[model samples]
Target chain A: MEPLINVAPYTGWVYPNETIFEWSVLIAVYPYLTGLVAGAFTVSSLYQVFGFERLKPVAHLALLTSLCFMFFVPLPLLLHLGHPERAFNATITPHWSSAMAMFGYFASFYVALLLLETWFAYRPFIVEKAQQRKDLLGTFYRILTLGSYDVSDKALRYDQKWILWLAIAGIPGAHGLHGYVGFVFGSIKAREWWSSDLMPVIFLFSAIISGVSLLAVIFVVSSKLRKIPIDLACLKGLAYTIWGFIMVALVLEGLEFANIVYKGREGVEMIMEYVTGPLLVPYFILQFAIGAILPFLWLSYMIWRGTTGRALIAGVTTCACLVLFSVFMMRWNVVIGGQEISKTGKGLLSYQMTLFGKEGALMAAALIIAPFLVLVVLTRLFPPWEDHAKSSSSLRSHA
Target chain B: MKKVSNPSLAARRSFLSKLARAAACTGALAGAGALGVGVAKGASAKTEAKPAAEGGSFPTKDYDWTKHQWAFGVDATKCIGCLRCVEACKVENDVPRNAHQFRTWVERYVYLEGEDRARIDSQQDPVNIAASGSEKEYRFANRYKDQKVDKAFFVPKLCNQCTHPACVQVCPVGATYKTEDGVVLIDHDYCIGCRYCVQACPYGARYFNEEHGVSDKCTWCYHRITKGMQPACVEACPVGARIFGDIKDKQSPVSLFIRNNRVQVLRPETGNAPNVFYVGIDKEVN
Candidate 1:
């Protein structure tokens, strides 16, 4: 295998040494952020779409979370593009064979659907509450109504049904949006670890886990903040759901690796570089043990004990692990690990993330944080739990 | 609405006879015209595109005609490792300050079983004609230390412009395209800043033009080829290790190389018909 360059005769620098695979970083962020949006929104929709009465308190909050992230999902890729202004051109002049090209239509359509769902879900609440305000928020909502603000029972029912059906259908669209991200990497035959049948299943499972966990944590936190009774039943059901998906996600990951190790290819040795090298700790410790096993055990223990408080805490903890570790690590492995192997197959290529490159960690942090800020502002404006029982007593206490 | 001066039956008959003759001539011309249209239609199926063809434009002829169009014919039998092509490419292409950003590149990997594997310091472009040294001499390289060294061979690198470019396939926007002449080109104006093509390039040949916000890759010196000049590297190589010409035109030097040698395309399994040929390619290069 005399390092494949024997014929071409290596002679010069490929590019400036300072740039260490900037493109891989961009790829990493698109799927990671999109997965979160899909997961978080799907969690928000569970109560609204599935008619789970207990999840009502956090239902609107979930929608807000989804909206915030849905907007940010495309930011990383946009920033990474050399000519971002021409990004819309992808949609207008799509090449059908390229899977990545399809993202343009899917993203735009999904955004429209999510926006309509968010608006219809909150339309009545907006019309009723807009009467008291002379502020910008109220004006936005008033304009949002297209000058036909109505709080009639029939109108509310119509809006609710519109939202319900949209939310119901939204599940597949969200899954497809997120699943396609996995499909892009999974379909790539160049990298062995990426080209796996379990990739889409892993994406879907992680989506459910991340989505459910995010809502559980947010709901619990908001309940405490507002001094309202937490919805114990919803948390329990969500914990069960999260645990089930986590189990599937973990199993799928195992199968992905087992199949590769079982029927080894030329790429196996190169992929092993991840095992014996830089990704070892991130893969084994963060992804497998602490991120996966600990959270699974904590949630399982709470689910069996019937202790609602413990379950909520464990659910929140699991969400923390998932957000901080799981999905991001999966992305890191695919983008960073996928490239670490050289074209020569002799050994690995050294690629460390640079601070100021287009795909740097600083850019990634900004992208991840931007959604939360958007979500917070939205929560303040709409206040998903503002109609809870506490308002009745506050008036009397003040008087 | 026009008035005829002659009112006699003979005058009217004369006008009718002339008009009838003109009408018959017009009818015969129209029939010939219709026949011509039919013939054109009959010829349509032979030339016009039909969807049922096994392949129209892509899964492209399973051979990259652009990058390898000037396929380098490195004869290992020809003994000499003068770094002339490397120097020429760096100076001509303005290769960056490091050995890693290799457009025309080379490396020597040494394998020793009992001893530690040895990598020779890349005989990087030494002419310094481009004044191409960084502050640190740009030390990012995968060289074996001064450890026990064994069998080593030199490999120079350039774009293999595969018929099926992974970069072209992955570009979200149809910004990157292969030219009719088989040269892969980036339509800078249409390129969205998405770097999928850069990542998807298996050869690591693609680089994002950070200044412009688009992926820029080797055009195999398209500018040079268009002007009847050899790629700077090929022109400068002292050993004639690099060959540049049209494979499509059999008389071209490249076609002669392909004709005379049992050459191999790197990573044929990738289905990217790499136009770059290597007479003595190692099996595991891809």
Candidate 2:
């Protein structure tokens, strides 16, 4: 069949085939989705393993968010594959030398760690809910209990110890999840925009920023919806962490760009053309200016002024939303931007995201929305805020 | 009762072992049979040609892949922007007729003396050159009629068949690989269509075959070459521009050409170690 769209007009010279990019917006979303998963899991680790008491309010929330996003991480990948049914070949008959072959293993291990830790953290609650109900929901909770009704102090202590160990192990597993995504692009020596030793590092930090920012937004919105007083201290703590990581991510990105320009690589001119011309708005305006710098400055001002109550919440929420947009734009810039320059270094190519095609924006939006829909179901079944409510009620009864 | 001989169990075990052995034997025979067919086909194609005295037969029997590494060379000076080779490749390889798909294509580079870069345009199918018009005429129509031309030439591009192919290294399922004969090939059934190899290829030689649902590229006409026939592109080159032969054969014209000419490969800085060599390659060619 003829291409529904002709090749976008290109300047100078490009191989005829180079006019179209094989990897598209779906690929861009793949890394972004995984980054959210990695970042959320890391935030949970900060509370579970690092003994950070202030992060307690959002610990379970963060873990739930991670699980929700992790479940949908492979959707974009499958959609991007030309033969989605054959994707499992990469697992069963994997080529070890290929970095991409490691994806299945890495994702499996990380997801397993996430599931196990989430179950252990919520086992007591599941057991309590199982005994509290006598209907089909009770049966479901009983199954979730896995036939062990031990909510004894010893069992709980053991669960805590195990949760800690898993969280410790999960930190690297989380890093590997998103780091591998970055490595996929970083290892491609052909594309100067992606070929950086710092790509993985930048991916990890930005992932944390996006994750923390997402948590901050979810916490505020969920609290407002539930009519619970917002946790200002928790919001501040998360904002501080998000601010720190964004700075690091921005610096690393800057250094990577500086190094490339200083080295004056063969493809630098073409990349410069891409950055200055076609990609100016997304790369400069959305990603660096509004996404990184604006949020960083806003959060810094909020922290310095020691703002509290409504103003602190507004500041943190706005920054979180902005950073979230920035990270998404960053992914778009990296994946799609890298493809804009021709491999020949003498031309540029263009991509227009189709609204209805398989790899189109609509599909990407659906994939993004799928996790949040799952999050709603998960939140209903295993409400992350339930434990906090129970603990507070017990303390009031004791008083 | 417990000590009674288990004759039925023993019989079943022996039957299973026999079946396993039979399966192994069948597998080995099938592999050998496939290889034998390839060798027979190559030999028979040669036998069908006229005798060597008539200068029509290629020495297919003398060139065993285990001992001979095949290579290709292109003389840019001899190329005249005639896209017969491009048409021949598509027909031979069953490449799609769409403009985006090409197994082999030619680029015309026009360098204005003082400019650091050349003006280049690649025509997807040279068979339609008349419809598209000649490069000179197109340039003239673009108001470059009075522009000074330092040098102009055509460079035909295909899969470099790199010794250290990035595509091979990046394939998640080992679907795309290099054969011992130095031809890079894709196992269409095994390819998951991840397009990672397509991205890894520095020369932009690989493309996703929408019809086949797999990554596709020029295989140097592996099937035809193994059957002792010239690649369609090489055979269709009216000016003898493209040269294809086993480089291990010291007396082969391609080997002699490589020995005599200061040939170059495209994008040597990529360190792909491309087996396709070019003569009179301009600096402007990527």
Candidate 3:
């Protein structure tokens, strides 16, 4: 069937298929979603294994966020597949040499690790809820206990030890998860924008920035929703980490661009034309200017004063949102922008994202939102923050 | 006396022994069954080979694929921009009518004197020479009317069927693969339609077949070639511009042409080692 929209003609020649990018915006969102998962998991590890006490407030929240995002990571991929049902063929008969063949293995292993870590970390709370509530919700918690009723101090110690080890193991797993995503694009030697040794590193650091910023926003928003005082120390520490990572990511990206320009290969002229033409808004304005530079400046000012207040919270929250937006735009520019340039080094193609199609922007938005909904459901089942609330209450009573 | 007293225990022991014996028998039967199937398959293969040796028609199931290395060649100088090859390929392959779904297409490269790069364009259908009176008359009336033309010619584009195909390497499932005979083909049933192969192809020769819901490309007319027929495009070329043959056969026209003429492949810098060779291809043709 013919495409509903007519493609605009440009000077020179393009392969017919070059006029229509097979990988859509849905493909772009796949990496962005996985980046969120990887970034959040890394943040959770800082408190769990590294002894960052100031980060304790959001540690559990971060793990939950990662798990929630992990659930939706493959949805965009499934939607983008021409035969979504045949996707299992990739796992069953995976060609080992292909970078993409590793995805099924990597995603499964990472998700499994995330689930086990989250379960072990929250086991004590589940046992407590199971005993305290005598209704269906209590029964649900009891079933979640997996028939293990042990909540002794010794058992709790074992849980902590295992959680620590899992967090340590997850560090590499998280890196592999997102690094593999970058390799999918980077290993394609055909496209200049993606074919860089720095692609994986850039993806990893950008993921950390996105993940931390997301946690910061969630922390602030959740605090307001629950009518609790914001944890200013935790917020300050997160802002500092975000600032450092953003700088490194920006520098790495800048070096890649500079290297490409310096080399000035045959494809460079066409790529330069692409960057200056259609990609101007997303690459320059959204990604670099608003996404990185503005957030970095605002975060730097916040970190410099060592301040913690309502205004500071509001400001950092805004910066976090911007950073998240920037990281997403970076993915868009890489995935879609790379495809915009025809391989012939003669012409450019335009992408008009369909709104109502199977693999459209609306579907991508739904995939992103589905994870947060899972987080909400998981909050009810596991109650990530309940144990901390209980301890604070007990101390209040004693005092 | 002790054995008689523990009657229930003795009965349980007897039942366990019986179960083990049954399992052993089942295992032996299954192994014999598998061996018998293997022998039958071997016998059938021998029978199929006997018929082929006696000069019977080549059956699809029994055809040995290892004998030939397929290759394609094009003489760009001979091409008159008549797109009969393109139309024949489309009809033969059942390629969709959409311009984007071409299995093969013709590109016209126009390089004016002093221009560093050539200006190129292509149409879904070839310029109709029959409808117009003559080549000179058609050129004067339709194309190059106002502009100064230094050198212009048609280059037919199809899958190069690279030996070290990036598409084959990037296919997560082994859906797209190179055959022993050097024909690159896709298994429609196996393809998950990830489009990785489409992106990995440097020549932009692969496309997602929207109708079939899988990645598709020129297979060098695998069905026709395997049955000892010229590819539709090669058969349709009026000027012998397109040639397809077994490169392994030193006497084949394609091999003779390559041996005699200065031949070049597209995007040699990519290191894909394409089997498609071109003669008289201008550097301006990418």
Top-lDDT candidate index? 2
Give the per-residue lDDT of model 1 (tens digit) for B58-136. 2223333333344445554342445566666656765543443546555444566575534333444233222334421
lDDT of 3 by residue, A89-123 (tens): 56544666799987877887888899899888777
Interface RMSD of each: 14.6, 7.2, 8.2
Best by DockQ: 2
- Ranked by DockQ, top first: 2, 3, 1
Native interface contact recovery, all models: 0.46, 0.65, 0.63
Off by over 4 Å in 3: A2-11, A386-399, B1-62, B124-141
What are the DockQ scores of the candidates, in order? Answer: 0.20, 0.31, 0.29
> What TM-score does model 1 achieve against the real structure?
0.79
Residue range A287-372, candidate 1, lDDT tens digits:
77777777888777776776667546656555555644776777777777666654444445555565665566787877777887
The stretch of ten residues in a row with the least summed lDDT in candidate 2 chain B is B1-10
A376: Cα error in model 2, Å: 0.9
Compose the digit string of candidate 2's lDDT tens values, residues A1-399.
Answer: 545332555676778787667787888888888999888887888877776667778888899999999998888889878789977666644665688987877887788889999898788778888999999999999999999998676677777778889999999999888988899999998787888999999899999999999999999999998899998888888998998898899999899889988999897888887888988899899999999999999988988899899999998999999999999998998988887788888888788778887888899999888988899899898888944446321211222
Model 2 ranges with Cα > 4 A deviation: A2-6, A386-399, B1-64, B125-130, B133-146
Q: Flag clash pairs in model 3.
A: none
Q: What DockQ does candidate 3 have relative to the true complex? A: 0.29
